[model samples]
Target: MKKVLSIVLALAMCLSLAACAQNPKESTEPSDSVKPTEEAGIYTPGTYTATARGHEDGVQVTVTVDANSITDVTLDVSKETESIGGAAADKLKSQIMDAQSAEIDGVSGATETSNAVKMALQDCLNQAMGVSSDEKTPVADGTYSGTAPSFGLTSQMTCEVTFEGGKMTDIQVTEESDSATGEWFASAQELFIPRVLESQSLAVDAITGATTSSNGIRNCVAAAIDAAGGDSSQWYTEIPKKTDTVKLEGYDVIVVGMGGSGVLSYCAAAEQGATVFGIEAAGKIGGDSVCTYGPMAINSQYLKDLYNNGEDYINADDVYNTWMEYVGSDEKADVIHEAVYNSGSALDYYVDNFGFEFEGMGLLGSFVVPEWTKLWCVYSADDDNTSWNILGPNKTFQFTRALETANAMNEKNEYMTELTATSLIFDDDGKVIGVNAQYYDGTTYEIYGKTVILATGGFLGNDDMMNEYLGSTVSTIGDTVNDGTGIQMGISAGGATYMMGTLPMVHISQVPHLIRTDDLTADQKAILTALALTTDQKMITTEGNVWGNENQSGTEDEGITVEIVYAPDYMYYVVYSQEDIDNIRTNGLTEAQANATSQFLSQGGTLPAAGTPVEDIDQILQVGEEYQNVIKADSIADLAAAIGCDESNLTEALGGVDTTYYAVICDSYAYATVGGLDVDVNMNVLREDGTPIENLFAVGQDSEGVCNADGKAYTPWGGQAQSWTFVSGQIAGTQAAAVAAAAE
Candidate 1:
């Protein structure tokens, strides 16, 4: 009887619609039986509310329908991320109202939020239509395939999904090309795929730091679900409770962090017959140390071998003097001597004990004193792609060595990852005892040890700490995991801080020039085009000073560092001629430009054909022809007008470029920071009164005084910092173990 009634109602609605279409003018007239407040239609006039899950939380929506059409839609998006998900809700609400339908295009970069809105609207519409809430119409169980648009040069991300009993049974994402070298995609897949299969929903939270790749997988899965005709409302999954607990206890020494210093400390303690444990806040072990290219060493067997082979080698005395100069004369000579003298022995210990090897030695210096290359160090392993070697010159090679050391000591040492050390546990006497840690799943644990080593690295990842210590104008391009938790713990335990005013490694404008060409105007782009055609020109400041290679400067030296002069208005140019352009076309870009261009290309960014031997200059010119910053003009006055600069300034700065073309350049960026806990030569943390804290030690970036040897933190040479990481770790580890043994 109910089915018959539904059929009759449906027929009546169709007749009403036909009548309205036939007499549009009459339909607009007020009907006596219909309420004056409502539009003329067959829909039941009422308001309906529905809720749907979103990326981070839930979205509730209310809809008002007047007979035939939706009159209004209100969204409650209190649970969404303020910037991204909140903006999506605001924009999508207007779009849905304008279209007068629940189905609408999603906002780019906010796909999860947009889908939540759509699902909420669908629920409201179904309620208004008097659809049975429990109506279970199963989609045909089958395999479905779909693809999402690529982010870059990579292929469109494709997915194959299998449905069983109207539920998602399995999903397989194809190995597609990714400009991030598959890291982001791999992380997203590892985190998102399992959740999608369990909850059968595409509204899962995006991966914390890999949102782009997470969205790609979500879009692909949504496409497959649409193909399978699956009902999205039924795909909701219950969120799990966080009740998992892990307890660990009774160790002689506990090292907080599994970075270069942490791993070395653990190994050293274990070698001394002391039971040691290590913990890392990140899911993986390697911290910022994994990202280092190489370490600094002085008077090592590697350097001796190089010297014996008649290669340029630095003397120990020169290295010591240069370091002292870099640190300033008033710096602690004893600390400096300790690090310099033991650096070679530390390297030897690691090589002899862990089978670590050095490929060769190299130099790094500051731009203020370009001639002094006091920083020299051994690189690990060969650059050649060969068999699976434990260490290499690659930035991540140290991580490999650390992981190997951890594995080798698995019998005697225990380690846990994804556990954050929140605070230090102290006895009644104010002596350091252990740490208070919390797991990723909300479970807390108290880990105790006789001696505690703080190898938690620097606070580069904490923007508040960086702004407070390094100044607000400073920026960072370092590891995101070094949040200074260990430093905070040390300070809470009455440890003094040191070297808080050091200069972090910084460079100007490392991003590819052409990547931002979309912000340029046609005239400016044309200048860049002409400049790309030129060759054999070095990048220089407007004052004709060398702008490149500013890394060779001495400590605290004031000059035009690359980072200081990388402003867009500073206006740099590559002075070149048509003949140089022809030569470049025949021989390709200079080695420096080629290397830079190659790095940009590897990241899936487009570049001008200026580096290639092409006959048509149009192709090269067209590369950044749309960017406004690449200003070009036939005359100095026109060029000034294009760049919005004074003609006199332009004329004076670029006098020789009247018959030639010049291309504007910007800064390159790279960053690392120093400054941490105050420590003695034994790596024992010290109080504000200069008394050593009992059983407390700091190493690696956690030890603040390492880079402050000369009173200035802005030391030339990357090797000094790298070498200190290892040397401090060895010192802290050995001393910490001895302290633990003495206590026993």
Candidate 2:
């Protein structure tokens, strides 16, 4: 019986083992050697965040996960360029969340931002999964070369980079075709390369006033690093070395800047037998004046002669009252009076001394009076009608002639180009005696004089000043030379500044050359083409507001002023159709419109011919389809989508016009600006206490209490600011010369 029981037990155990082997689910105990697949959804549920180096700074990201799937993703991209890297982050976040994985394709135009997002996501996933962060792949240390496309010129910039111990050591521009490009690169490199080496990352602050060159350098360095297989790490940045200073003395008058006022002041002082010295920040002489049309004079000999010959004449008192009412201030009435009375003489000086000639009187506004038209003293060249035309008809003729005269005068008086005035030197008696300047070679100089003229123009080039004063990011369309250095110096030397928080000389048209055809994408081309087509259209802020022909009435100024003040966000839109285009082509656009059309054609855009019927509107359609700020929609709802406004609101604003196509326009360009250091009737820089700062004078846009006294309106065609440049400069120069002569 015992033997039989043992045999049965052995058979039962064998059967059980076979059954367990056949059906794995039947097994009760778990196997320790087996591994789970990724599909098992093994992850801790929580939110995790990480930061990675990006194009211009750190890109921080947060990721939320539920079990194994990504629930949400957010990014902190304040440091990224809004147009490029910021757009990338927005797109990449959606893609990563949808994919629920870190592995994803990068944004086409924003590769650095894409990589940064990927790395940050990987780190967050590693944290959430309780896994160690993967180390960056090490790169071999060696020298590498790369090149970046040019911006202003027709050539590329080549850069040589050296690496030490898998880290970037040095970066240098080996070849650059354009001299201006080379200088911009050098300026950008001074700030960018050192920061890259210290941070061990491509992210760095772009050099101010040289963003394109700075980005070029960064891209070139990035390419070289990729070629040499380099990775980023945290490192220390080094401080830049300072340049040495030199002292120069023995001048009666020192004029800072070489703009309209600066040149005029120098000439006026030299004529008074004062030893004058001129300092210019740029290589050239003309400042913002080189971009102007002509000057305004209330009672010039030319205008008086026309009036005597039975032409309509404007009363000086009427002009004065109009200006005073416009500026909303009679506090500087004496200064205004002087400008109105002496403006003609100042123009006479330029015409008699520099061979300047007036082509014809130009009507500044839609006003029909011959007197108002006579205010615009258009200059003429000897041979070429286009010689004076830089951006507009007869715009730069006066300035060009002034530049020639200034150069000739420089042969007798001392003048230094590329020497930027840094500060005013004051004596124990609180009088400005000289100026401190810095040359492009990094060497500083102390220039002594009995009198100093602050003609540094407006501060549009300085972003900090603009933000502090203008309350918004205003685009500068003129030359980038007016940096407000003289204004700052005057303030530091006990002078006062005024009317800073005011509207600049804003223009209706888009910034010239902002869109280049060769570099434009299809969407960009379409939007720009639409903009070009609507350039000459009569723009209206609200529906039902009609503007007549260019010379319809004297109400154009009032209309434009009201439009600018009432337009939302200081923006307006142009309304037109195929019919308007045909009309414009038939009647022919004004000189300004023709110039804009010519410019558009030069940028590789096409225009419809006269009497042409509506054909392809693809380019026009593309504007609403692509751009966020612009709109080109057939319905109000679609237009609202493009402009980010309520459909009802937009429809109401458009006066219930829901069928026609519409495009919004805003203040796209800033030509110049007014308001800087406060000045008296004599153009002498004044202190906050209303006392004149002896031996220091401010002129042109550098002097306050001139143009835009009301701080909201501007006289577009009267050459108000240009006229002030001549009148104020004459007064300041004459006063400065007198002071120097008395001292001698």
Candidate 3:
């Protein structure tokens, strides 16, 4: 009797294991279509919970099952992006319950969080079905493709992953958006792909300046892993970091940050015969400077003779006086003089010595005071420069070429990327010496030198610093690696800051969380950009008050007082009625569509002709609604409710809406903070009492404020920031080399 019982029990166990081996389904039908509990019996009556990795941390799901039915479902997606992922939680839960299984349609814009929720919910259902949860589901050997959002809202990064012997052997980016900067994306793909393959894990740190790209790769891989019958949560094993120290001594000058300014500094010091060492936090060399048009030059003789009839583009003396007047005082007259008069010579020095190139001289005139002397020129972006984009020309290769020349000049002149400088090293008597840095792979470095140059860009990437100093946080188009490390190091060495509250460089404006340019066809982008940029109709703030006529979205201004800068959070909504939408789809866009349209949108395609109907306007609006960028309603009160504004305020703003209405979101973007460490004309870091730190220097955005004033926008002349990189870099590099030579 005992033997017979044992055989029966063993057979039952085998059947259970076989059932668990079958692939789990997310959902097959909507909740309303699911059969009643008595007709479709699958689960044991109980509650189960599971968690999976999400955009931030983990998404949790608790599923309550009755015998043959899913009774209730709850989720915690708070760790995801509030506007995108978090907002999709309720819809995801409803779909799971309705299907009475794990399979369901995912929310459109929240792919990452939706996947996590589905994975977690499926695990819960598996648990309630009496399956073992100790080990992960085995991944089948196959190649799979998946996609997730990249930098642009409309664009997604598609990845193809191959699995063999239950291991991810190969991964490749099959499709990506052009809206993402080429340099940053290349850096992300180079470093992140290898790390993921070696560890076979998703818990890797994002590339410092290419975080969105790194996350896009990770999320898309997770989707592929799910498709291959693997438990993605199991592959999220964390990577370990080393905690060891390495030291080096005897360098003449150490430059922190290998951006435009730092590269120039390295070149200047190397030409002066100094053994220079450079440390950059990002995977590439150029920082925000690569994304700029060009520098301001008052009288660059090389440019004058090349572009003009051997005459300076603008008067240097006149510029000096105008700049002084704009700043309101001569508190730092010598530094302003160098910024004005030395600007042309600095441009010449780089062209002659460093292999830098510039072409096309003309106007990048200030928007603040339109008549304030046009002094800027554009960098050369010939056919060989494939990195050029509509936002800015590709000058990153020029920096790379200059660095190559500097490296050739001196064997000891070297720079390391993926290495971040943390603090300044000092001697016993308190003179700045070198820098303490850490490699991305967790190696510590204590590099010693006779002099140090702080050129780590500015604090735009640091949220805490931006909020504390600039009064509020703003969107940035520059590299996110400029987190004020250099400025903090300067303060650690008793250096003072100047004009820390000065306005950031705001230039472009677009729809908030814009659809990636590559995701849409040319015609779609044109129609969308036209609708978002149009201010001809009534525009309203978040509070539902009518916008001022002069508050055009792209027009630059001082402070946040006027223009799109004045909009709360630098965002507003353009209101349109059903008649307008009908006219757009029927008669075509009117002249009103051209009023405030962005020239940058030309990258997409030309705006449709006035009074020519756009055949796809309705489809375009549907896509906009899916991304939560467009809100539509049948009544004014309903529209107000969708926008989270008082009905009365909206009614007043729109003059009592009588038809269906739509609101399109618009936002302004900035480059970086212009304020930084105080420095003299020689680019020497200054103490609070107005004395220079003997062996220390500052350059680029790290000390560009000497040319501007607090409580105002950066010297509105376009490319002024890039010009400072050239001017201050030459001064600091040569001055630091002199100091090192004197010490030796």
Candidate 4:
């Protein structure tokens, strides 16, 4: 009888809908019924209020339903505007009446409100369908235990659950870091309260700093009731036994350099399970990379082909044409370009898999129009080849995808450590096998592995090697370090060399010999220390004098130590008198006082020489010929004549100088050296015969000749050692690993 009634009712409703087309207003809508004032004694459709907390402004909503139809919806509390929740609420309310079930779609812009409405509707619908208030939640009243894993480390946990009428009411989170991580536990408790009471679920996202804590709590709670037979896997999954320690081995592949390229290769080999090691005589890691200030050109034919289709101008339309610009007729540069272009793949792999952050390295002036400064260059964040630079949203030119590929191999694997490689151990066949390391012990240890990588850094510390390899004062140009440790080592063992000729300069700009960094700002350093291309020649200085190497008047002292180069930080000052020294050390005193103070001078510029009177500056200059002050000169005319500067330009430049500023600058300042290393395609050290030695490599500023086909150009400075250290190190590391793995 009820089935028949349902069919009859459905037909009658259809017939009514057809008849209503004749008079649309004749339909009996629920709101059109006789309005009834609220009478306490009378029965009316129950109005349920839904509320959501933790929102920025808080939220409240009410819906009135009559029979199986929604009468009205009102928002009593809200902080959102029409563009957000307001607009969505309007659309949602209109569809609520027609939704026969709780499977209605949510509003577009109002996700939170939509969810709230869905839950509210679910509640109201249950009552309407007569589902009774006897529904029950899952109970957690048993014991559970499990292991939490991360970073190849596993922690254990156990919990006993208690429940109230089939609903979980309490939970406890314990961990090894509990004593020292109380604050993290407090914050975690705050977040966990909602998941248990509101959502009635225990699974949650891991907390940022308190990852271990959050995971511990979740795993314990999740496993508790499951061990009571709720779900077996929830309590204990068949997890594999973890590996905690790695054993040492004999290296099979050996590398002998630690420059940008060398380190990159070595790191690669190490990643491949090679007992990778780098040998650098320098105290620091960055070699020529630290001292360089420019970038290299890497061209990908395929990417260029794709770029040309767009509005951007790329060199890929013609491979030979693009090749001529960077490589010219020299096939070696082409080989270098091919190697570099492909290298991006590996870099991309490294950044995505490892924890590397890339800021997009691409052409700087390629897309810049003379009239428009809005868009300058093309940069990109292309883990999946979609995102771009914050400034230029178009594309990227240089691709580090090469490194990315190698890094991805360990997507489910782990690396043991990131120790700085110090030296490589080689075998008789010239193949690298292992390393001797300055491991945390501060003493050398013979680490036996299958492969050895030489990314120990460059000879930024070997001054003689720089002069001998590049045939110039490459050492005096940029970093005092950049000595050619890699080159010397590689050459001693037979390696090819190329591009090792001129010491690049930042132009012929005359920079200060010594600077006081304590007072100078960054902009001041850029201007004073950078190269000046407009000029041709530069002045040299030695120990505050024109003849720093030796005073002719005092006889040869230090063999003409005229090293007119930039200071480490370009801020070297001298102070005297305890009060003045303490003033600088303790407080600023005052702006005027600070500006007027001497940063690179004592009470007097010079002292009495032998029996000369201290008050007479001229007399002291003549008598103090043996001291560093002998090189000091008051005017550019004296400086030019003393240091072999052109007399005419000296007078002009000196005239342009504000005497006060020039006096301070000439007396104390900083200088920057732009050029140094030169290398062949494979980065091997060349013998005097022009051929590379077997199984030898050099990287960083150890040897000149990486750039400048015609002459000297700026080096890729700063993290130069850092960039190549990882890149070349990785390669060497991987090769070493392969060798080791193969030997094993």
Candidate 2 residue-wise lDDT, 1-744, digit = tens? 011101111222222222222112223222233333454443467889988655544788899887657899998876765545765677788878776766565454354466567667766765665543323334567788866543333345678889887677888888654233223344465666676777676545555334556556665675565556532221112234349888878888899987878988887787667778899876556666655556786667765565446343456677777767667777778987877777887877766666666655554532323346567565454466634323344333355465556556545467877687888888897778889888755689999999999898888776567667765444454455687898898888888987775567664444222332123443334334444434456554333232234422333644442234333334455654434434443553343433343221232344434333323344333432232333466676766675566667566555665564546353345656677888888888888999987788999888744545433646443577878888887788889999988888
How far in Å is the alpha carbon of 728 misplaced in model 3?
Answer: 1.4
What would you estimate as the lDDT of candidate 3?
A: 0.75
Off by over 4 Å in 1: 1-238, 302-312, 362-412, 473-478, 511-602, 609-668, 709-714
For model 3, how does the per-residue alpha-carbon lDDT over 218-283 read when each residue is reduced to its tens digit?
Answer: 877876876776656456565678899999889999999989899999889988889899999988
Candidate 4 off by > 4 Å: 1-249, 252-263, 270-313, 316-331, 343-346, 352-355, 360-363, 366-442, 448-452, 469-482, 505-710, 714-744
lDDT of each: 0.59, 0.60, 0.75, 0.35
- Top-TM-score candidate index: 3
For 1-744, candidate 4 gives per-residue lDDT tens digits of 011101101222222222222211222222223333333211135676644320112345566665434566665335432223554666656656665333445443233344344444444433433323243224445433433221111123334455555555666544333212122333345554445544445433333323334444554554454443342111212123323323245444444443345545644654664444344433223233332222222232222234433233323323224434432345355433433343334444444444333332343332212221111112333457553211122111121233344335444211112222444557787654455544221334455544333333344334354345433332122223233434444544455545443233322222222121112223322222221111111223322232222323221321111122232111111211223223323442233322232221111122122222223222322222211222344555655555454656555543433221121122221112222333345544446676653234444334323432332232211122223333334443454455457666
lDDT of 1 by residue, 575-656 (tens): 4444555666676555444434321213333334335653544344434332222334566666556545566766666654
The C-alpha local distance difference test score for the whole of candidate 4 amounts to 0.35
State model 2's lDDT: 0.60
Better of 2 and 4 by lDDT: 2
What C-alpha root-mean-square deviation, in Å, does candidate 1 show against the real structure? 10.6
**lDDT preference between candidates 1 and 3, better one:** 3
What is the overall TM-score of model 2 with all chains considered together?
0.60
| Deviation from native of the Cα of residue 596 in model 2, angstroms | 9.7
> For each candidate, how many residue pairs have backbone atoms clashing (under 3 Å)?
26, 1, 8, 128
Q: TM-scores of all models?
A: 0.65, 0.60, 0.80, 0.39
Q: Can you give the lDDT of residue 496 in candidate 2?
A: 90
